[model samples]
Target: MTEPLGAYGSVVEMLEAAATRAPDHPALVCEQVELTYARYRDCVAALAADLARDGIGAGDRVGLLMGNSAQIAVATFGVQAAGAQVVPLNPAYTESELGPVLKDADLALLIHDAGLEELAGAAAPKGTRCLIVGPGARDLTQPTGAPPAPLSLPDPQTLSTLQYTGGTTGAAKGVDLRHAAVAVNVAQREALLPTGPDERVLAITPLFHVYAVAMGLYLAANCGGTLHIVPKFTAAAVLRDIERHRITFLSASPTIFQALLRDPAFAETDLSSLRVCSSGSSALSAEVLHRWEEATGCAICEGYGQTEAGPVLTYNALHGPRRAGTVGVPVPATEIEIVDTDTGLVPLAPGAAGEIRARGPQLMAGYRNRPEETAATLRDGWLYTGDIGRMDDAGHLVICDRKKDMVVTAGYNVFPREIEEVLFAMPGVADAAVVGVADDYRGEMLCAFVVGAEGDLPEERIRAHLAERLAKYKWPRDIRCLAALPKTAVGKTDKKELRQVASVPPSEPA
Candidate 1:
């Protein structure tokens, strides 16, 4: 019987327990490198020692700015092992883009990749200790097999991570995750992924994000499973590696699933070992979900959560029935409450749109250093998950739209998702993001940024296409065809950023 991990003190305790039980097992794999439990254990210890030498101790925030690599894994574990909270910065963040996170977080040390050294130099604090961890990075990847250098770390209840929620809100703030909270979230994620000691899982998603950490590292740690970490996400490379490693599980967003399904060699690839797939970060379109399940002959489960909640609120298990668009029932030990904006959680009889409210042990400590924002978000012990969704008779939660993302035309409420669903049903539209832009006539006009099939799909053609299925008001007045939509860290269309760039002052009329 698997002994459930109730309250492991820290990452050090978690890794040590996993290692002591299975030292000979391979703990991690990233292109051309395989690290056993014992080797990985020593690596964590040495890396922790190095961190303590550089003045990073318990609860201190260090930025992890790098792509998906074995070193990235080692660095994350190493930072936690040294008793510091790691703020995983998105590699795409420019000096200006990264400014908010750097300013928001009380960070002193930055372990950035050499590729980002210039940006790091520009973004680093006045007296920040920034270390490069890439090709020319001085931090050695090879383990020296040293003991952990000691520090006066607080109790395990102290914050271990400061995950920044994706944009929509103007200035991003950190979600403080306590040791107890993370353990609950990790255990919930591990419960859903059917893996074992010998089995290997693909880590194609960005490890900087919460979803990847929950699935790739934490889940793998619990089962003592091997993590096949790809450097970055590329459909062709992912397919090749899946066959090469006999990968048992693939965790990713729907965009990745669609890309994989489109690959010509997808059929010929040796996908015999694939056990199941789990998708989140965005809604998985119903059509694509069915297509992948049809093609691969594997179960694809839907999981949903946010960075503020240690990232797992609900997940689909293998035993339950897989609904088409639902994000499954509440994860074990997680609770759900749907409420109206004006009032508290009023249980809708059935099939009613309301804001999703969740309160559980897996919840984060609070937003780091932003007490007012934290107080507003984490109120009365429940997270007012700004997402609008409903519970069905069967208990599955179906998210309709973000509370802010829902478009309002005049006095009537028009959910962008309602229109996007109709657009996705159309043959040519690949993906879509609908937002309300300013208009002189209507209060706000619905505008769409769409990615069409590989061809010249004109705005009029798209308008004509949606006109058949949508109401006149909901039909997007401005339809912009995109090569690919800009994505937030969690893989959803970065609509807020898109709106910002779209609304940039018209160059002062040049």
Candidate 2:
């Protein structure tokens, strides 16, 4: 097994070491541009110096509002190198969606894509300064006659990233992760899924998400490997890059994987270069997993995590027996427990279902500015993950569903994941989600929303399929099919929208 990158005070130090180890090696590749490790470090240092000159340092919050590109990657490390907390915002957010976050973060500077300048201006506060950057990071990489100023390296415990949670459940809260925590999580993931210097990582997920940063960006930097960034996700584009770039490692969501499988080009695409693939952000259905692995000959290692736990708590070991339908054991130094959902005090035995709680060095310090929530979530050294799951006898975790997403109808508790899995296995069902809507007699009713492979899906077919697989109570009271399901910024199914839509009367079934 390849050894993990030992230790780093901050993520910036990881980049510095990579640059020193392989100066001329390609570090970042996006579209028509590529930057070597040395050039990548130089761009970060240059941006850091510029931010430092503007009086942005420790205790200041800087927002990076851009899509997945070489420029955003540089800006991320640059802000942290200058000793400020980097807040990564989604450039796709409307001004209304961005306004509350802008006001809440109290940012000193917001570096954004040139195209998003108008949105940034409308959303940012009056005194907040905004810097516009283009696609290739040309402005940051340009040579200045004078040497760049020394970076203001932060203390290990200093707050580094203030990543906001995807608002799938409710309002998005900023997760406060320290420099040491972020660096340690990278090392933790490396311990289980080791990568070498020759590795080529393809990153289609948004860079703003913690999963992308830890698994895609920092993971590549730790090994002095090349990170290929895709600004957007399209089946054709991803398939083309994988074959063209000879990508060895890929980290993406189930939605992305399903799209690739549905594309006509997938059958002919040369995926022989893919050695490792990871799925996160949401659950991966058994049907999709089987199809993908059978076609590509690469097992998709499904993992479980949240933004609060440095975005990684557990992952399937690369060399071990990969279990189907379970997110594998906790990474090194992480302790996980199945606690009773009600009081969260009693520990449950293996094979018993309960809330999953964990404690680890990579855990976030707390949610920013939300003391009450922090106290409730982080207690007795454990982060109370509100996700409901069970630990198998073999120590693998089976995620049932989120606590809030569970349904109680006719006095029977039902997990949406169970029914959704059944839905995913049905032919013509491309994507599926289940939400509990209020009902007068049943207290709450299970409503399933599905996206068909080609056109409108027949509700009767879904009902017939569920009838054979699931219990009568587990069957959805209503089945609605659409062209596409609403997704959160991080590519999670937005159940909140489904619940809202399900509240209204159902139209005639297709």
Clash counts per candidate, in order, are: 1, 0
| Consecutive 10-residue window with the lowest summed lDDT within model 2 | 135-144
Candidate maximizing lDDT? 2
Candidate 1 stretches with Cα past 4 Å from truth are 5-7, 145-154, 406-510
lDDT (tens digit, per residue) of candidate 2 on 1-510: 233544788889888888888899999999877999988988889888888889999999999998888888888999999999999997766665578788889999998887787889888989788888884534655535566654556889999999986333335578999999998888888877889999999999889878888889988988889999999889899999999999999998777788899899999999999999998876677887899999999979988888899988999888897898999999889999999999999999999999999999988999888898899899999999989999998999999767655665643446687677778888888999999986654557899999999888777888988876564767888888888999999999998998998988766332
Q: How do all models score by TM-score?
A: 0.79, 0.81
TM-score, candidate number 2: 0.81
Candidate 1 local lDDT, 126-158, one digit each (tens): 777787866655544576654544323335787
Residue 508 alpha-carbon offset, candidate 2, angstroms: 7.1
Clashing pairs in 1: 58-83
